[model samples]
Target: MFTGIVEELGSVVAVEDRGLDARVRVRGPLVTSDAHLGDSIAVDGVCLTVAELPGDGTFAADVMPESLRRTALGALRAGVPVNLERALAVGGRYGGHVVQGHVDGVGTILRRTPGERWDEVEIGLPATLARYVAEKGAIAVSGVSLTVTHVSDDAFGVSLIPTTLAHTTLGGLVVGDAVNLEVDVLAKYAERLLGAVAR
Candidate 1:
């Protein structure tokens, strides 16, 4: 589990394709400082187990074919900045909402409207995931937890403050950039429970 709190902005060092899976090396000094082999880390909101600690402030993780197909990790290449976060420790402060690092779908950046201190970014929400999103509800875009400012049948908007704009990879995203989306897990649970009750 993660809190959607970004620990550091890391960059991809290398992505070695191994047919079905790609071994990705990411350089995150802070997250790799106390990291260990097999430790879980959230890279741009995708939970990946550390396969190797390369001892150069970088960790290697295998991006499976499923992960690549579901998230934007497949598009990662050298020099790509990624939001990095260590898994939440026991009794750790919950800075953001519950984030499983399990992306439900991939969304495309539809448009961006710059404001004085923030920018409103509209993402093309997938139809299957649209029902799980609500205005003012929490959503994780590429591992950065954000509150939904606006919602429609096919899209949603999130505001990036100055801090977020300067910190996360969202600031660099363009109109066609793909982003991983994880809706509020609690909402999914509620829907499941209500469905059981109705039946």
Candidate 2:
């Protein structure tokens, strides 16, 4: 599991395809500093296992077909910046909400409104995932945990502070850019239990 707190802004160094599967190598000096094989890392809100530590401040992970189909990681190529976070340790400070790194769906940046202190980004919400989002709720966008500022039937908004703009890849987002979205896991669990009880 992860906390949706981006540890480093890593770049994709290489992507090698092996028929139905592919291997991705990302350069993350901080996250790979003490990394070993088989460790879990969240890459753009997708949990991927570290298949190899290449000993060059980079680690490689194999992306299965399912992960490629579900998240934005499949469209990634060399030089794309991705949010990287190591798996949460037991005693680490939980600054963000619980993040399973399981992306619910992909959303597109519809527009961006710049403010004096922050920016409001509106993302096109997928119909199937709309029920999981709520105003003032937590959502992971490309692995960065953010609070929803507003929600409409087809879209939702998030406010990005100065720190977030400077530190994460979100600042570079443009209109029509695709992003990974992960709704709060707690919300999903609650819905599941409620449905079971109703039945």
Candidate 3:
């Protein structure tokens, strides 16, 4: 489990494709500082296992075909920046909301409204995942946890503060870009329970 707190802004070091599977290498000194092989790391909100530690402040993870088709990680290439977060340690401070690093769906960047110190970004949501999002709810976009400022049937808005703008990959995002979206897990759980009760 992760809290969606970005510990490092790493870059893709390499992407080795093997038919349907991919091996990705990322340079994240902070996240890999105490990481061991098989540890879980959130690479742009995707839960990837640390398959190899090259001892060069970089770690390698294998991405399966399912992951590539479901999330945006398949499009990653060398030099692309990624948000990195190590799995939450026991008794660690919960800085952000619960983030599984499991992308529920991929969303598209629809618009960006720049403010004096912050930018409000609107992201188009998939219809199936829309019901799980709510205004003021926690959502993970590319592994960075953000609060939803506004919501509609097809989209939601989030304000990117100066710190976020300067620290995360979202800062360089443009319209038409794809992002991995994990809506509030609590909402999904509630819906599941409610459905069970109704049945």
Q: Top model by lDDT, which number? A: 3
Q: Report how far off residue 197 is in candidate 1 (Å).
A: 2.0
Per-residue lDDT, model 3, residue 102, is 83
The models' CA-based lDDT, in order, is 0.94, 0.93, 0.95
lDDT for model 2 comes to 0.93
**Per-residue alpha-carbon lDDT of candidate 2 for residues 106-199, written as tens digits (9 for 90 to 100):** 9999999999989999999789888889999999999999999999888899999998898899999999999999999999999999999999
Off by over 4 Å in 3: none
Cα lDDT for residue 25, model 3? 98
Question: What C-alpha lDDT does candidate 3 achieve relative to the native structure?
Answer: 0.95
TM-score of each: 0.97, 0.98, 0.98
> Which of the two candidates, 2 or 3, achieves a greater TM-score against the reference?
3
User: How many pairs of residues collide in model 3?
Assistant: 0
Q: How far out, in Å, is residue 126 in model 2?
A: 1.0
Compare candidates 1 and 3 on TM-score and give the better one.
3
lDDT of 3 by residue, 1-199 (tens): 9998898999999999999999999999999999999999999999999999989999999999989999999999999999999999999999999999889999999999999999999999999998999889999999999999999999999999898999999999999999999988899999999999999
**Residue 179 accuracy (lDDT) in model 2:** 96
Candidate 1, poorest ten consecutive residues by summed lDDT: 63-72
The segments of candidate 1 whose C-alpha lies over 4 angstroms from its true place after superposition are none
